[model samples]
Target: MDVLLERKSVRNYTNEDVKQEDLEYILRAAMSAPTARNTRCYSFLVIKNKETHKKIAQIHRAAQMILEAPLAILVVGDEDKAYEKYLPQDCAAATQNILLAATAKGYGSVWCGIYSNEERAKAIEKLFDLPTNIKAFSIVVIGKSTDNRPPKNGWDPEKTKYEKWK
Candidate 1:
């Protein structure tokens, strides 16, 4: 609960480099996400190259945060591994786990969507030389945050329904 409350999308980052051990911990959390029918359809691509990050930023306007962060973890969904209907869902779960784990480890992170955008996905696939069977789902930019922002309460009781539509 504490982690969830504190989790914020951090776009600005300091120059500090992320340790390999912390990255491994985050990846472990991502792999622990539940999947449909136990079919783990996700794969991760870790990019630390400055040139690559810049190239990715150009693919999407909101993804410019990747250039500010030290690294970006590209979460790919393998359609061949799971049903087409469940690939996005499974990848989303894994992405949430990564975000939560990063916050717990004192790292700042932001999710950059890629799957639904056809042009962006194609550009990423070509940039990374990914095989046709796998498609980029999302990218999590991670690094030491430059500034701390207060957490906001997201709970809205008005949005919930007890049993059926009122």
Candidate 2:
């Protein structure tokens, strides 16, 4: 619960590299997310090269922070492995798992969306040369954070409803 509350989107990061074991742990957590009909449609691309990060930052305007992070993980969805139209949901769950796991590991992270944006998605696909069956979903940039902002309490009674919309 503490981890949940403490998980904040960290954009400013130091140049320290994330460990291989820690990356593996985060990927494990991502794969552990529930998928629709047991169809795990997610694939991950770990970007360690500064050049690749710069290219990604160009592709995603909000991802300029990627330039500072030591690494970024691109979460993609494989249509061939997905069940119906649940790829987005499955990938989202996996992305959330990545963020939570990174937080738990004492690392800072941020999620950058790409799936629904046609232009951005196409650019990313071209940049990575992804197969037609695979689609870009999200990129999670991670590193040792330089920002010290506190976590926000996102709970809002106005946004909650019980059992019915009315």
Candidate 3:
């Protein structure tokens, strides 16, 4: 529960590299997310090269923070492996798991959307040489954070409903 509360989007990061064990732990958590029809159709691309990060930053405006992080994980979905309609949902769950797991492991992380924009998606696909069947879903930048801001309380009773809309 505390980890959930602490899971905030951290954009600024330190120079320290994330431990390999911690990276594996986060990836394990990502893979454990619930998938539609148990397809487990997501693939993870771990980007560590600064040059690649620079290229991504050039393409994704919101992903400029990714350049500061030690690593970024790109979650992709394969149309051939996933039920087409549910691919986004499965990929989103996996992306959320990565953020939560990174927080649990005492790392800061931020999720950068990719699939929502067609041009950005196409650029990313071309940059990474991803196959036509595979589509970029989201990118999670992870590293030791320099930002120390506390998490904001987001509970809102107005957004909740009972059995039906009143």
Query: Predictions ranked by lDDT, top down?
Result: 2, 3, 1
Among these predictions, the greatest TM-score belongs to 3
Cα error, residue 24 of model 1, in Å, equals 0.7
Residue-wise C-alpha lDDT for candidate 2, range 28-77, written one tens digit per residue? 99999999999999999999999999999888999999999999999999
Give me the overall lDDT of model 3. Answer: 0.94
Q: After superposition, how far is residue 66 of candidate 1 from its true place, in Å?
A: 1.3
TM-score of each: 0.96, 0.96, 0.97
RMSD of each: 1.2, 1.2, 0.9
Worst 10 residues of 2 by lDDT: 1-10
lDDT minimum window of 10 residues, candidate 1: 146-155
Q: Could you tell which candidate, 2 or 3, scores higher by TM-score?
A: 3
Over 4 Å off in model 3, which ranges? none
Clashing pairs in 3: none
C-alpha local distance difference test of each model: 0.91, 0.95, 0.94
